[model samples]
Target: MTPEEKLQHLPDKPGVYLFRDTAGEIIYVGKAVSLKNRVRSYYQSGSRLSPKVRALMNRAADFEYIVTDNEVEALILESNLIKEHRPRYNIYLKDDKSYPYLRVTLGEDFPRVHVTRRVVKDGSRYFGPYTSAGAVHETLDLLRRLFPFRTCKQKLAEGVMSARHRPCLNFHIGRCLAPCSGQVGREEYRAMIREICLFLEGRQDDLVKELTRRMNEAADKLEFERAARLRDQLQAVRQVLENQKVLSTSKEDRDVVALAQNHDLSLVMIFFVRGGKLIGRDQFLVLGAENTPEEVLTAFVKQYYVRADFIPGEILLAEMDPQERPAIEEWLSGIRGARVRLVVPRRGEKKQLVDLAAKNALLALQEVEQEQKSRGQGRDACAELARELGLENIPYRIECFDISNTQGEESVASMVVFEEGRPAPGQYRRFKIRTVSGPNDFASLKEVLTRRFTRAREERELIQTGQLSTRQAKFYQLPNLVIVDGGKGQLSAVRKVMKELGFAHIPAFGLAKEEELLFAEGRSEPIRLPRDSRALHLLQHLRDEAHRFAVTYHRQLRTRRNLKSLLDEIEGIGPVRRRALLKAFPSLEEMARATVEELAAVPGMNRAAALAVYRFLRG
Candidate 1:
């Protein structure tokens, strides 16, 4: 049906509406109290729609609607649809990747704690969408040091524990109670797990009280060793608690969200407070923010908390639209299985926290703006380059491929990425030469290009099928333009691979070192830009960086090959043991400096083999 017909037929009940372009792609998604009124409002004369909305209508050709029971359900569905499609016209949460969470396997007989990137419904308790992997590891390390929890995957049933002769070395090191040893009772192990849960949930005061009670009970029973361990754990917990800033005296869990915007950039800072103590803070950067502060905050809160595993009962925000507050809060409260409040603190300690978060967001925005200025907004440069190349689309994300090898020994390739004319080093990837041999640039280029695009397709499929997430897929984001570090032959090879991989629409160019000219597909003449052109310089920077990265990776591979050969000369060292040793000590020099004990600590190695390795390197 035509968009006019769809809008006329839209139901009066609360629901979600989707506007699609000629290609049938959803360009925008929204929910409203009345679908007919909200969807039709866009087309009303003199509506004074924003430029973004006007642009959306310019491309939009059709519309669809889903009737819901109530406004809250419509709001929930709108958030889900926006996250799923990521419509161009909608405000969205940036870096919408799966953050690491601390998972406790409550389903298991003896629960164990570990960090996971995925949240599944397996009766496990999850806490966190930690912003940093390093912070997650630090927390896990502290937990291990303070609590003797098992790390291994040992099944400890009534008969299984009795069958095992001894527990792993963790028991000896006091890092685990080793329930499989048939010594520690299930109740005792479970009690420790409970304490861990409380500690992770940021209920430090309650945890301290529980630990004190347990310590006193152990002392009353004359269990001095257990009492001493409890005493040490208590001291550590107290120290951590003391360091945490007490943000409130209410002991209620809530998230403080505040936003700051400058021009097209927006930053949202959120502070997580539990049991009245400030635990952690995470900030998000939102670009192209064209809405009001209240609208942006509403959009952010909806997008963020939709994927959040745990929703606090109370959410403190600087401002929210009064009309939308009830529906949003109702939706959140449903997710949390409790009544949730959306508070706009006028004056109080909570208001102070909101102000502080806003201050942080402002500071973060300034630093980001400064960094962007230093990098130089390459939008104009990209546009100029696209125009010069006679391309239809601007290359917002450009990926260049380069191969490096020495006589085909230790062959490797590097994929360097630049987004909006700035280097995105985190997206850069290196591939080992696996298929072809010798210093054949064309064949190697074909191989790496083939692998690059092929992996992109695979990761895309994995993400679509719910088997993999966008963040975990290294090759998921395909480039707008491709650059080869060679002339016609290399470009031809890359073009062949791209066609085979069904990505022929993506333009490929080859840069010749001698003339500094670009060779384009289907064009007999090479494109030449002036020496002082910024576009030419940008490509040159990419080519040079790719070469440097690929060469560095090749050298590291060659060093590892030499080290492996040297280790193979030892009588007892086989390929497996050699790889292990090389992996443990990256270089022969480092291995030579390691003592026998250090070498023995490596997996699949004993004191005898460790001594052999030590003597062989020393001799």
Candidate 2:
């Protein structure tokens, strides 16, 4: 149906609306109280829409929507859809890195704790959508030193533990309780888990007090060793607590968010406060941000919290639309499982904290702007190369492909992207060669290009038809230039696929490694640039990056295959035992050097099985 017809029949209920371009790609996503009124307003000539919205509407040939039960549901669905689709018109977060979270495997019999970038709902309790991975590591290290929890991925069932004759190295080092070997009781292990939870929650005072009480009880019962352990833990906890800054007198857990924006860029700073102390801060850079401060903050809050493991008791925003405050508060409260206030403090310490965050945001934006200016030279080189090659558009987005294999074994291809002369690592992709049997570079190149572009074409069609709302289709938008790591033969192979796939307009070239010669699509003679030429350096950078990425993936696959083969050669080492051994010792060298007792400590491995594997390796 036409957009007009769809708007006319739109429901008055709360829902999310999608505006699709003529190509059927969703260019915009929006949530509204009344779908009919919200959608129809866009088409009304008298409505004063923003420039961004006007441009979006002009290209929007069709639209679709999903009806939600209420505004809260609609708000939630909108955030999710926006994250999924990443529509051009939405103010979305675009950082290349994902924040890390502390994951507690609560579903396991003897729970394990670790840091992870991905959060899945499997009865796991995750904490701290920490800004930097380094911070997460530091926190995990501190926790490990204080509380000796098991870090293995082993099954801790009674049957598996009964088969183990001894604990692992971690248990000997006093860094784990050896729950896999039935060395620690479930109640004792669970009590340690409770302490960990309390410590992570920043209830340091309560944790310390509980530890002290337990220490006193142990001493009264003449358990000097247990009492000494508790005393050491209490001291470590106190040391960590001393490092935290007491920012608020009210002892309220809160998050202070602020942003600084230019016409094209925005920097958001979030300060995490727990138990009246400032724990840490994170900053994010958002590209293509032309929205108002209120709109940006609103979008940031929704996107940020959806992935956040913990929600603060109060969220203090630098700016937010008054109408959106209640809806955001309701949505956050539901996710947090408690009442969460969305506040815009206008006075006193709260306001001061927000101001401090804003100041940090501004400083971060300035640094990023300066860095971009320095990288402008690389972008200029791309523009120069475009003129030299007589291309229709400057190669702002360039994708390079390389193939790696060791004698046709573990063949793989890597595609690396450069945007505005800087590497966009998030867009980097790896493909395992499937169709081509051996190390046929030409055929392998053709197969990889076909798969890449075919999917891109399919995604483009789906987006234009409004059939697909979200896509991580890196190839959906064709790169302005393609570089393959080889001579004219590889270039010809890739070009043939591009032509067949109707992507011939994308200029492709091959950079021969030895001579550093560039072979264009139709040119016979190689074009040689000066050794110090910026364009040559840029091309070389891209080619080298692609080669590096492909080799890295190739090595990873080879290592896994080698490990599997080695394990298969050992007697009584089935898939389960093989997996456990690999999980315990990732490298073959590590496994080969492991003692029988160490190998036996792996869950599901009995002494006999461990001895067999150990003897096979030693032999």
Candidate 3:
């Protein structure tokens, strides 16, 4: 059916609407109370709309809607779609970094405590999207000193009293419970783990009380060593509790949220209050926000809390639409398995907290703007590049590729990207030159470009066919500009690949370091730019970064190959032992520094093999 006819038939129910352009790509996703009225309003002539929405209407050709049972369901579905597709016209929570979390592998017989940046459901418990990696590291270190949980990667047999493994140095140092040795009871180790979890969850008061009781009991029983350990742990927990700021006297869990905006850039700051104590705070940058603060606040809340691990019973917002309050609260409460409230306190301590959050947000927004300015990301580098290249379209996203190898050994390629003239390290990808056999930069470049664009085509096709979400397609987001680190030869290779892949329309360039010249397709004369030009500097930075990344990967592969070869010469070392040694000590230098006893402590290593490894590395 025609788009207009389909719009006319849209049901008058709570649902999510997805608008796609001619290429069958979703450009915008939104939720509506009445699909008929909301979706139809975009088509209404002379209706006032923000420039962002107006731009959306210009490119949106067809749309599809999914009706939900209620507004709460619709709200959830809308948030999921936006996160999945990350449509061009929808506001984005520009949080690219995967915040660190403390994970406990609960499914294992003896759970281990560690820090991780990825959260997956492997029967594990995850806590804290900690603001900084260093902060999480410090917390993990403190926890290890407080509790005795094993951090080793050794696989232990469950409930086996006569296990064959020996306890490591950590066991002797009182840093681990040594579950692998089968001497530490599983329940005992798990009890300590549960205490650590309580501490991480901001239940330090309860933890202190439990530790005090245990210490008193141990002392009465004349267990001097155990009593001392418990006493030390209790004192530590009390110290931590004292250091935490108590934000409220009510002892209730809640979050105070506020936002600050500068033109299109918006920052949302949230303070996490657990047990009426200030546990943590996080800030997010909002992209493509709407004209109103209410809309931005709602979008931020939905986009954030959807992926949140913990939801407080109450959320205090600086501003929100009154009509949106009920649906948001209902959605959160459903996720939390309890009733939740969306509060807008006009007067009281909550109001003061919200104001504090707003001030923080404002400061953070200013800092971000200043950083962008200093990086020249908010300047005219893109326009300058277009003018210099005489291109028809301005490049919003630029991608550069480079090849690295030493004498045909461990050939590798790196692809680096810059969006809005800022380096996007998260999107950078590297490839081990599979097809090329020698130090052939031309062939390697051709292979890398071929793989990159071929995967892009396949991913785009999958997304269009509803087989894959946009975010799942890593290569589908085509860059507006392509760069290769070479002269005319690399540019020709990229051009041929682009033509074959049906992406000939996209602009491609090759940059050579000597004289800093740029080569484009069908141009016999290389384009020369002033050394001080912003566009040239940007391209130079990208090329250098790509080279550095590629060379780094190449060196890593070479190092591994060398290490494997060296270990293969050891008398008692096989593939398993080699891998075990490598896993234990990533560098040969570190391995060489290990004592025979230290080497024997590694999993699957016997004393004879450990002595052999120690002698071989030394020799």
Candidate 4:
């Protein structure tokens, strides 16, 4: 199908769309309130699609879409589809591992309380998609201490089969009601669950009252041990809540998000207030954003909140996007099941929250600016190196390649991009080093960069032909510079390949590992930049980010390799068995720490296998 024909065929209805190459691989995915209108905008003048997309259009042989019942549904479906397909053009959240959430299964007879990541309409109540997994687990731990609701998934699976077996270690540790053992009666467990629900709902006074009543009842009944336990649980919950500061008490749950930008990067800070308590704060660095702070924040709010299941009762912003406010508010109100307000607070507590969020935004931006200042020095050094090597431009967009491996296992090449003066994560690329057999950094880097630039050349042609679409490369076009994270040897290797491929215009450089020196053609001695130079710092940031990205992949590979080796000694262990064990236990160190009984409890590991593991660890 022709690209223009595919664009014409897009439905006018609200939904999500996918763009596919001739080989039927999805290159990009996007959603729209009006699919046809939005899709057509790409061909319009002044669209933000990068030059690379403009070239890739010729290869986009077909298009596909799924029409949703509504825009919100479309938004959710788009997020799921993107996660599943990992389309190359989408702005990924980067961290996709499911984080824990507090789940209270109100419909169950025993009402199990546990940590889960997936939230579905299963007659259970869920509290958060908390940014911090540690914080979520801590809160859940405190809840279990305050009220010993059932933690046994087996009990829920068996439809509340309350066998009076011995209590698990959690019961001994004072974190469970031991409902499985019938130590806590049904009525008592129900009452405890109620108190926990109240506390989670921000009715601390009611929770404390119920706890007091239960403690007194136990004392009067001469159950002094039970009374003392309740007293300790109550104290723990109170202490935790007291430590949480109140951001506002206007009986509203809200979030204030503000963004700030300087030169090439952006900073976004989110202030989370739940039931008037300032739960915590988070900030993110957005690289390669060509939009203003307000513009970025507006898109962020729309994209982020529309995909989230939980909606705040209100959202106070430092900057306003009037065109977007109504749609956002209307969308949020539906999710909240109430009238949700989006306001730009100018005074009082609401305004204070905005100010707080904005302050955080400023601080985050300052950090990025400081980072850019350091990187600018590196960029200048790289530009000087390029000049010494007889290159064209200042090489503002630098791409660094690094290969990581452990003695030939899990060889991978990472490409980290620095645009203007910062590490652009959105443009960072990873290659599994397909051609090289074992631990050949030069070969791996050559193969990765060659493939990258080859595809880039093809994309540039498609774009120039007016065939490619913007969705393919919104912020990722092409790098003006390439820096291999190695010395003159690596630089010589890259130059050889570039000349062979007949691509000569783009400049390239290399940084030596020893003495932290820079290298270029015709420069007999290595060069250095001032510590505070922004351009040089930018190059260093890119190089470090490449190292970091490569090291991270290397570590994951190493961990998986170690996990497999550990499992190999077990009698029944195979690929699936080893994977399950690693997924459940994570590390050899963690597996070593687990008791034989704990190891046996993991799904595939039986008594014999667990014993085998235990003996191996001991040996």
Name the best candidate (by TM-score).
Answer: 1
Between prediction 3 and prediction 4, which has the larger TM-score? 3
Q: Which stretches of candidate 4 lie over 4 Å from their true place?
A: 1-37, 46-84, 103-127, 149-175, 197-206, 209-232, 260-268, 282-310, 318-321, 346-348, 361-619
- The per-model lDDT (C-alpha) reads 0.87, 0.86, 0.86, 0.72
Please provide, for model 1 over 220-339, each residue's C-alpha lDDT reduced to its tens digit, 9 standing for 90 to 100. Answer: 999999999899889988888888898888889999999999876688899989988898788877654477788888898888888776778899998788889999998888888999
What's each prediction's clash count? 0, 6, 0, 25
Q: lDDT tens digits, residues 1-619, model 4?
A: 6768877777779888888887899877777788888778666553466554554454566677889887767766775676688765444433434645678898776787778878789998877656567777887877666676667686442335356465665665566767776677777778888887777665676677889899999999999998998898789777877898888767567778777767656677887777688766656555432455555666566555654546677777777667556656776687778988878877997888888888888887787678767777656665764564456676667788988887988898888877655567878888777788987767777888788877777777777887886458432267677788888878877877777776656667788766667777557777676566655656666788898999898898788787788678677787776876787777788888878777776666677887888888878
Q: Output the TM-score of candidate 3.
A: 0.64
lDDT value for model 4: 0.72
Of models 2 and 3, which has the larger lDDT? 2
Higher-ranked by TM-score: 2 or 4: 2
Q: How accurate is candidate 2 locally (lDDT)?
A: 0.86
| Candidate 2 weakest ten by summed lDDT | 157-166
Ranking of candidates on TM-score, top first: 1, 3, 2, 4
Per-residue alpha-carbon lDDT of candidate 2 for residues 468-501, written as tens digits (9 for 90 to 100): 7545456687799999999999999999999999
**Regions of model 2 farther than 4 Å from truth:** 1-12, 95-99, 158-169, 287-289, 370-619
